[model samples]
Target: MTEFVLVPGLFTGQAVWRDTAGKLAAEGARVQVVDVGPVRDLEAHIARVVAAIDTIAEGQDIVLVGHDYGVYPAVGAADRRAHRVARIVYLDTGPVQDGAVALAAVPDQELRERLAEDGDMKGELPVPSREEWSRWGSTAGVSGEALDRLTAHASPQPLGTLLRPLRLTGAGDGLPTTGVLCAESGATIDTVRMLLRFGDPTMKALVRPDVTFFELPTGHWPMLSCPDELADVLLRAAAGEGTRLEAVGEEEAGEEEAGESGYLRPFLLDVPEIPRERRGAIDLYVPEGGHVSEGTESGEPRPAIVFVHGGPVPEDARPTPRDWPTLIGYARLAASRGAIGVTLDHRLHAVTAYPTAAEDVAAAVAEVRADPRVDADRIALWFFSGGGPLTAPWLAEAPPWLRCLAASYPIMAPLPNWGVNDSRFRPADVVAHGGTPPFVLIRVGREAPAVATTVAEFVGAAEAGGAPVEVIDVPGAPHAFEGLDHSDAARDAVGEAMGRVLGRLGLE
Candidate 1:
């Protein structure tokens, strides 16, 4: 029989795992639920879990489990007793890098700020209100009674537990690990696989054979929302029955009929390349004649559509986003439609770099408008992917010169796990301010659930605010359909979206 030990996350007690623990005990497994609430420091928390491991019979390895913030100390304990551990299960949480603190890893940026505002390094953090719980993670499928019980037993998390760094000696590297993902909280095996394409070293580590994943359809606190299912997943995870993650190219090779790799794939339409001028971090594509309708000598300047590529793109991604086939294709397509096409390399290299990325884009726009070849009053900004959130400031208060905005399969709101402050970078909330220019959204049917949820929220918010939004729905396509999906619907959707943007740019 497998011996089991479980650690609960912030604001939670051992009673929160009562149902799941009982189920595990009923299955003939020796169960132990570590009470980390009494501890006010990380060392104490780790020591408590370590003490539980010591209680197991000699030579009998145990399966260790960590839920949410509790994973930090659980990992520490596992590191100290790796030889005595058979498996490590991560429930709705990912591994934090060495020297990282739990407070920085909190899913909600606004909540993180509020918790740290007191500047009390040694103080505890309070539990959020019931309505504010969504900021932590989605509360989908959680019962009212379960929530009340959770609140009743909630404890203020020790500041030391969150403020202290989780140091690892690399001793627990490559341990048999199971990741139990909560799909509603914006964590899924597919998202992990997607991040793998960016070649993030952290994501790359998950490809090990011993590392497996299981995704639950509910929210962050699955033990309360779906205790029976969570219990079963925990058992299966201990048995090593979850799906294994593959590295980027490895997944493609495993497929019998492999499609073109995502970024390398061709654009939806075939358009002739136009004259290109390479500026610093900015590329300008001019129309075929190299003249703005023979009125270049006069006061008439052509409209410019600046395409902002989406990222958190790897700093070392070859060809970069500006050089990607899709960006180049869009720029060239804009040129074909009588508009100066602009693409720039922004500094949105990480989720936290949004401010810098926004600054980079602002500087690029100012530079573009100053050029005599472009009309400053007729400028439009087109965004994609993660770049979607950057549209917030402009939507909040559009300048007279900013004619329109467009986003293709964009993430309108920050997902719960992004740690992005909700007060800013929320286009869904800002679009309702009504000082926005005409907006266009090219939505995909097969977008990732978390992304789709944000888009839906934006659409609903836009409708409520009476914002002028032209939504082009591609029911058969997926996110990044311009390069990934080659069907007629994708092609038509791209063409229609471009025409609408061109029209908004005063090019039609």
Candidate 2:
């Protein structure tokens, strides 16, 4: 109903939106690219965007498209001017995350983080020189000269813009949203797949009938590679067209059904309620395509990688949006070697309390272990963030029936002390069953290092107790690592780590 306006992410300005804007306008859609930069804070940044959109809108419904960091301002703009804003076209940029989902979802979603972590008053980060930008886009026809011009013309973005939490209360309420993605940018793609992994509260909240979806074959900067296509997607969505995929299950698509791919077998389970716990369930993601291995003479199946995604969206309940990153972790990365990967929804939310989450994990392992194709003895635990408190103890005191164990950033130590995420602490039963499997811990520096710290503490305690342990650390990564969705390096590293762990556990 309202016209269409776009908000730019960090480092760039409305200049980047030129191509896309033209295409949308050519289609008879009223389009405006708000240059809310050269501001001091996110609040100010948003106000500027709103002021510009208000001027262009002049009293009409407006569809909004946000690219990268632009997502934050878009939310602010929508929130501030909800009546004039109709729908949103989220390009490459995923959803506006909740107040710092513990792991911070950095590095992978680096553009925004880097801007926030390393921004100047001029709205510049340690950007790859104009030459670098051109080289990256050269294959797609982007030139350094164009990039230089854009960068020079772009105004500085403030730090608070990236750090501020989004408040979409009255603004985003009842607004139809369209998530348009670019498949080529590794980070952007990873963000979509790893929606749960990277702590994307925005996508979780928008999964209802209100939000439509679309995918493009461009990189994070679609205005550069697939401008025409991106514009087309936004216009159609603005004019009221959405994807058929959204029509599937309205209410409970269930965690397992989220992000269901060819290599993944996601299924929901009505789990048993344990003492000290309320209603609970288990979501599982196991490598599916390959034949169930005919066990050795002992009649045992291959072990599995029990994965606990980062605690970003408490209501995610399943892997739908979360499994975007699993494409690499489950299908292309780990499964090819003959392994089983499982993702579970623990009692991470207050609404989904303690013993309940622990029970989900136990039941998931029990269920997956029962599978004839799996080698139950080689089972390993792979956890993202807050996933630790439940995982660490389970690794220490797993059932005798289980085998090897592994976890990354398993949160089991002191909170409020490590500058980590302890704000959304949901109570849970921590089972420290002794006599667990050989432990393998993989830590990519930036993503939840708590688990790594836990691993170190455990290693120290084990040393005193004479126990063996392994730890791997990745550099220049964030709390969510590649699972966070922006850094190709993090994605590739974590995928490799998962594969290596699975191989060692003999899941391979």
Predicted structure 2, TM vs. truth:
0.50
Off by over 4 Å in 2: 57-59, 97-128, 131-155, 186-204, 249-508
Error of 1 at 163 (Å): 1.4
**Model 2 local distance difference test score:** 0.54
Best by TM-score: 1
The local distance difference test score of each candidate is 0.82, 0.54
Q: How far is candidate 1 from the true structure (C-alpha RMSD, Å)?
A: 2.9
- lDDT tens digits by residue: candidate 1, 251-314: 5563211323354467778888686799998999978654333334334578999999887877
Error of 1 at 29 (Å): 3.8
Pairs that collide, model 1: none
